[model samples]
Target: MVEIDGMRLVQTRAILNYIAAKHDLYGKNLKERALIDMYVEGTTDLMGTIRVHHKSPPKEKENNLSLIIERATKRYFPVYEKVLKDNGQHFLLGSQLTWADVQLTETILMAEEKEPTILSQFPLLQAFKARICDVPTIKKFLQPGSQRKPPPDEKFVATANRVFNRK
Candidate 1:
């Protein structure tokens, strides 16, 4: 949720669309906007898998995490890879960045936190994530100590760094 002045916003997609509209990130035309919406929905579905992993019981969490990772890596990510392949662009919808790209980046980050090597098999998607992270604003936002969440597990971070060749 977001609060601006005296008004508040709820719902992830609604808030993202509102912000995208205000910032002209929705798209240049109706068809582009529709494409962005389609990708945003796809990202949301991916987020649902993360949510399930996070909410599973202690006894079930490990199994659930494995399943979530499998589904995300094997199923959802291929769809994104194909989209990027077909679009032939770094961004999801077109030549420019959109809310969908931003949402997908967040989903990728979440997945990486859980399974650091997840993107190794999907080079296009890996590059797509890197392209988004390379944006000036996003780079600054991702700098060390900038996020509120605790640091990722050391093992995961090490694995991710090794797989992605990050320092």
Candidate 2:
């Protein structure tokens, strides 16, 4: 477990990577493992940028969101798609599960649920999100009300609601 800003954050990606390595998910070579690294790094960059933008003030975020999504989809989404296109028997990397697959799937779903139109231009990405949600672990994590909203982020939410037209 890791603590970030007093939040007990677990290193999910590290755990998944360890599991994949132990389970022989990577192809039997260094190059194959490198490919998984590429996928994880790229996806992490995309999601991290999005997370930053999500927590930004609406005024700052409004214009940035489009650019953020555009760049993420153009760069990150296709990488995952190509990975899946080659190794997408079940997950982003392959029939075996990996951290890249889990992270990308969750990021895409959270994006779609919050802003459905962002990835509409990429059906493959949309399908990737759907496939992710269909996975047993992910499905369980996303079960109805399995997670709660961020306690309304009271101060921020109230300010944002007032800034926007939300009644």
Candidate that would win on TM-score: 1
Q: What is the C-alpha lDDT of each candidate?
A: 0.83, 0.68
Worst 10 residues of 2 by lDDT: 148-157
- Candidate 2 lDDT tens digits, 81-133: 66667765467656756656766776676566446787777667777777777
For candidate 1, give the lDDT: 0.83
lDDT of 2: 0.68
For residues 90-131, what per-residue lDDT tens digits would candidate 1 score against the true structure? 788758888889888989998888789989889998999999
Best by lDDT: 1
Please list the Cα RMSD from the true structure of every candidate, rounded to 1 decimal place. Answer: 8.3, 6.2
Q: After superposition, how far is residue 102 of candidate 2 from its true place, in Å?
A: 1.0
Candidate 2 TM-score, true structure as reference? 0.70
Colliding residue pairs in candidate 2: none
